[model samples]
Target: MVEIKEIEKSFGRLNVLKGVSVSIPSGKVVAVLGPNGSGKTTLIKCILGLVIPDSGNIIIGNDNVKNSWSYRKNIGYLPQIARFPENLTVNELFRMIQDLRKGYANIAEAERCKEELVSVFNIQSFLNKHLRSLSGGTRQKVNVILSLMFDPDLFIFDEPTVGLDPISCVRFKENILKQKEKGKTIVLTTHILSEVDEMADEIIFLLEGKIYYKGSPDELKLQQQEATLERAIARLLEKNDNKINNQLPGKNN
Candidate 1:
């Protein structure tokens, strides 16, 4: 459902993304895993049009994201941090969203979806609370509910399970599986490998602003002669370190 080819994004003299390319198919779950400062966030932001790429093309379905806003109607995104007007109650915030999307969302449909999401994410208990009064976990739930409010063709989540408890995290994963069964494409960034193994059909391993590898969890294991995803990643990093050391002109014993 999404295609990025030779994408490059640079911040002044520092380049964050260089010649990155990946294709995510529809109705599948794709997990992107990377260490800190790996440009995973940058890549996702580029897809959302938050950070414009210096070069390369991002295509969503048949629409070129740079050239069309129409494709945006089919996307739903949940950021790691959600910012809301502090004074608004959860109900009011949800209502405000309904008002904004009235032209695009059928009133009954949107209301039904919103109610389901609020219940699914267990946000109903905090419906009367203002954004400023809610806890981090509660706020995260609200953000997730907002993403599902549209029931769009594609769902993008960045560190979506960050603040949730175990039960809540399981529920979130189940919800993702349900969405995939309905033929919705999903792209999520996560540092949790166990969760990725359970939820992802394909894994995109991004490192230092580029795609280090992309394959199924089992395939990745085979790449490193290991039977586990964690081992595979450990081996990949060690291999990269050796490669870097080999390139140095003067080396230590």
Candidate 2:
């Protein structure tokens, strides 16, 4: 459902994505994995049109996302760091978002989804509380609810389970599975290898602004000759350490 072709992005002297290409099919959960500064977030931002690529294209369904905003209506994005108005109460925030998206989203469906999420995440008790007063986990739950309530065709979650309690994490996984069953496409970025192992159908591993590996978790482990996803990823990184170091700025030839 998503296609990226020879995408490249550079910021001043720093190149973040270098001719990266991948195709994500519908109803699949794809995990984008990379170490710090590997351009995973930049790639995602490019797909969402938050960051424009210097070359190539990102297409969702048949729509090229470049210089476009309407395509975003089909995507539900949960950013790595969700920042909301501190003074707004949870209910107020929901109402405001609903207002902003009135013409785009089905009001009855959005309300039904919100009710289900509030119950599932146990957000009812804090509905009247100010966002500033909620704990990080609670705030994260709010973020999840906001992103999921629209029932968009595509879901992009960046560190979605960060700060979530154990039970909430389990619920989040269940929710993802439910979405997958409904044939929605999902793309997520997380440092938790275990979560990827448990949830991802495919993995896209990036190194220094390029795709290093793209396959299933099991395929990755087998390819790296490792028993587990964590070890496989570690081995892959270790194997490429020299290449990565040499590519760093100021490294002597």
Candidate 3:
């Protein structure tokens, strides 16, 4: 559903992505896993056009992402942090989004999923409250609802479960799987290894601004000789650290 080719991005002196290339297939859930500053967020932002790459190209379906905004109509993006007017009630916010969505995409299609998602998240009681009055988890639920309301073909969720309660987290996972069943492509970044094991069909592990590993969770675990995805990732990071440390001057090989 999406293709990234030799994508690179640098900010003045710091390079965030170095020749990153990967393909996300349709109807699958792919997780991007990495530590801080590993380029996971940068890669996702490049696809979203929030951050333009210095080189390479991103193709969604058949069209290139450069000089194009229409492809976004097919994408539902849940940012790690969603900022909005705190004075607005949740219902008002939802209405505003529904109204704004009309300009770029099918508002009817977007509305079809709104009620179901709101019910799934059980945020009916919070809708009349202002955003500033809601707890962190409640706000995150609103974020999830707004993103999925579009019923887009592609879903990009960055740190999606950050403040979600256990019930809400479970609901989110189930919803994502249902979307996958409907042939929608999902890509997400998260630090939670258990979530990756449960929801991801494949994982693309990033380290030092590049893709260190890409495959099934089980495959990665077996390759790293670890019992769980978390341990496997830890081992991979440890190895990378040792490799870098050993290359330092006067260090043992």
Q: What is the lDDT of residue 52 in candidate 1?
A: 88
- Computed on alpha carbons, the lDDT of every model, listed in order, comes to 0.89, 0.94, 0.92
lDDT, candidate 1, 1-253, per-residue tens: 8999999999998888989999999898999988988898899998988888999999998888786677777888999898999999999998998897777767679789888878787777899988999999999889888888788999999999999888788888898899999999999999888988898999998989999989988898887899878889999999999999988988755
State the displacement of the C-alpha of residue 245, model 2, in Å, after optimal TM-score superposition: 8.0
Better candidate number, 1 or 2, judged by lDDT? 2
TM-score of each: 0.96, 0.93, 0.95
- Model 2 scores what on Cα lDDT? 0.94
Give Cα distance to truth, residue 250, candidate 3, Å.
Answer: 1.9
Kindly report which residue pairs in candidate 3 clash with one another.
none
In lDDT terms, how accurate is model 3? 0.92
79-152 in candidate 3: lDDT tens per residue?
99978799999989988988877887677766667877888899888889999999888899999998898888
Q: All candidates: CA RMSD in angstroms?
A: 1.4, 2.8, 1.5
Better of 1 and 3 by lDDT: 3
Q: Which consecutive 10 residues in model 2 have the weakest lDDT in total?
A: 237-246
Give per-residue CA lDDT, model 2, range 156-226, as digits (tens). Answer: 99999999999999999999999999999999999999999999999999988999999999998999899
Off by over 4 Å in 3: 103-106
How many residue pairs collide in each prediction? 0, 0, 0
Give the CA lDDT, 0 to 100, for residue 230 in model 2: 98
